[model samples]
Target: MRYAYYPGCSLQASAKEYDLSLKAVCNRLDIELVELKDWNCCGATPAYTVDPLLAMGLSARNLALAEAEDLSVIVAPCPACYKNLRKAGKALEEDPELREKVNDMLTEHKLDSIPKVKLPLEVIASDFDWDALEVERPLAGLNVACYYGCPVARPKGGFDNREAPQAMHLLVEKLGGQPVPFAYDTKCCGGGIVFTRDEISLDLTAKLLTKAKAAGADCLSVMCPLCHLMLDAYQSQAVRRLDTRFDLPALYFTQLMGLALGLGREELGLERNMVAPFSLLERMGLKV
Candidate 1:
């Protein structure tokens, strides 16, 4: 199970734990992650808003680099990057004119070809040895609320189901953990507006957290760094602003999966997180 791994800028910097957890889990699962050489930013939301073609062109350049490595599938970690790459690939496949324009841009930039882009979660499930991923000491009593923010599984018909996607839920179940249903699983955390409208972002986050907590979710399992930031980092601020108390610990789906796979806490980079997971795991009777 060898594939090209693209750890976007955020994962390399603030989200280093994501990279560490992913590497550890992949190693344990016998999945080889070969990183693309000298990859650049995927031109997330900024480029798409300013110029769609430029965004596609930037994403296509990275795909071209992956093609140079003779890899068909690329595993992207960042949700924003995954959305950009997936959308660019879809746009190029659907619209021939856009494809030619992007290709022309690629030619101008001296990039050769484009390879298929895929999110790590989807790629792992689609093309991996599932039988080998059998659980050792599965999480029996843990309750997780699967949170997939706007970019990862939204705008409909990109990769998976948008409204009620069960990819993460299924993964949680595989670990013997129960995925609790909540109202705001697919709701936006006001990610793009976090910088500009802090109040609205915090309010939205607070609402989601409160709902998830009420729904009996001890921890919110996530896949996106941006969502993790808003839900975990801004949680205290959101609580302060709303004058409410919500101590929901947000864990990366991979991090929780790694723990279930019998990997030690250090391997999952649990210590690097802003939201302390020890109390949450202990509350669930999970040995941390």
Candidate 2:
């Protein structure tokens, strides 16, 4: 499968591992990703909240760029980017007024067509030939609590089931790992509230982590970098604030998949995460 890949702002900076691991996995899976040139941010939560048109305009510009490349499909690795882009494309695909307004904003890149925006997880789950896939090392006993994050299945009409998505579960099994079903798989992690409403965000994260820990998950396999920051980075602070002991490391699903594919830690940028995955994987009887 070939498509235009948009790494977004976070992937180029804080979430470089997502880019590396995703590209590596795509390569192994025979998926070609040609990056959309001069792409900009999809205007994530803040822009969408401030102005829906502004968000759609920004996301639409990227879609227009993909159209310039003669590409009809775009794969966004970030959940927020996927949501924003998919939302914009779907909106433009349906509403001509929004499409014209958005096309007007992008004088440089005209929207000749609205491309299909997709998440890597959905693409990989549906397209990748799991039966033909060969893993270097099987992750037999690793228990993973899949965290899809808020925007992933939100606004209710994306690709998969909003409330109870199983793409991650099936992917975990494909990697030879056990998927641990937990309560907060699709719960909100309190994005901006992390800084604005510290207590609320921390408490929410603590609650989610508590459930995953209770489920006997070795670590949480996540798709969104923001959720990784909240669940893995702020885990210690949340534990301290909640006065509870929850030691769970969160890794991108791609990182865990890379491990199962026998890729080295550094190659997948495993060390980029705030919560190091080495100890957790080591504890799972894997020689990390």
Candidate 3:
């Protein structure tokens, strides 16, 4: 199956590992991710908060590009991008007047409709055929806390469940990894203000770290790049701030999946993680 892919700004810069690993995994499964040409940012919450029309317009522009690609689904790697893109697409399809206004702002002109916006994980979990899928190495003894974070299953009923999400657990089982039932799985991670507001970000991340460790999670498996940044980059600081050492690493889910699918470490960008989980993978006899 093929889908229009949107890497977003974070995937190009901070979260390149996620993009690489996701592509590697999908390629192995014979899934084609045709990137939407000349796509722009989905205009995050702050942008929408400042100017609603501009944010929607920006998101609509990307949708139009994807539509031009003759794609019905757009798989976004970043949670923020997926959330905003879905929001814009849904809003436009529901409101004719607003859709017309947003279309006027687009350079591509008339966008009668928008495609479905979703995360890569959702596609894998819901649609992938388990019978044909191969696992080169089982993720045995790996206790993973599937961190859905905020934007994943938020803003009420869209795609995934808000409180109890089980898709990640099913995937962990498929990969031979134990999915730890971690508290605060859907919690927020202080987002883009980790530097500006260290205390809040640290505290929130600390809560997740502490909970994951307590739940016997070897590491936290995250889908969103921003959540990866907060939990991976600021985790050590959160431990220091909390006066406890939670040495659990934050890993992108695709990284683990790629490893299971027999992809090389370099192919998955495994070493690029802030809190590298290679040691744990190596110890578990997972060939890199």
Candidate 4:
């Protein structure tokens, strides 16, 4: 019913729509999202490859802070943050040396090992009563392709099935929507290369969206803000670069869930999207 929420850096800036929609949906669903105060970045992209320990340490600090709170789960919206924290948390829990180093770093800031870290989707889809979610709304008619895209389901330590994740599909079914299976569901969205080698990202995203479209997915669902950014924001560029016209709307899993729960477009932050959901809303018969 209640969980500690970490919006991470992307949600605060690039992914603010996700944060807003999540809060609005939680309010509508009577779920409480308690944001952890003074939570810093989950080390973002820079820390990961350069210094793995520093990345873990930074994530550990945030995790330690969240764990200190009286909550067992921290629902992170950003895949980067979720992956970083989840990997760091697993490392801290299983790898004694890594745990000791992280703990020492945490003590430097007067913190302790805190609650476990997880993506909000994972926690909500798994920990909560699935039957209750099914009763909320029927997402059976809507065709959705679930995109895991790197961090959220990787590292093989956290929750959900590693090879073929069905959690999102289960959630989609709970919301009365049909989940369309696709090949690139767990494939990289070309995230890290988005800024540096943008052409590659655009091409990959274009192909991914094309695959989703070809799979008969009316819309794409994702838990990662970065994935949303790549799929939604960069879509136009991808289309331009690849000389193709694919206008499939990308929806945050929370946004679609909120819509199905009888929430309006504004409530679900549909206005902040790069790829307009007007047609999709029309398909869903939702008035904007």
For each candidate in turn, the TM-score is: 0.91, 0.94, 0.96, 0.89
Q: Across residues 1-288, which tens digit of lDDT does each residue of candidate 3 receive?
A: 999999999999999999999999999999999998888888776888899999999889888888888898999988789888888888999999999898888776468767988788888977788777698899999999998887656765556777788777778889899998787888888766787887888888888888889899998889888899888877888889877775688888888888888899898998888887777888999857
lDDT of 1 by residue, 213-260 (tens): 888998998888888889888889987876777678898888988888
The TM-score between candidate 3 and the true structure equals 0.96
Off by over 4 Å in 2: 49-51
**1 versus 3: better TM-score goes to:** 3
lDDT of 2 at 239: 82
In candidate 1, list every pair of residues with a backbone clash: none
Q: Which candidate leads in TM-score?
A: 3
Which pairs clash in model 3? none
Ten residues in sequence with the least summed lDDT for candidate 1? 107-116
Candidate 2 lDDT (Cα, 0 to 1): 0.84
Separately for all candidates shown, the number of backbone clashes (residues 3 or more apart, or on different chains) is 0, 0, 0, 9
User: Candidate 2: worst 10 consecutive residues by lDDT?
Assistant: 151-160
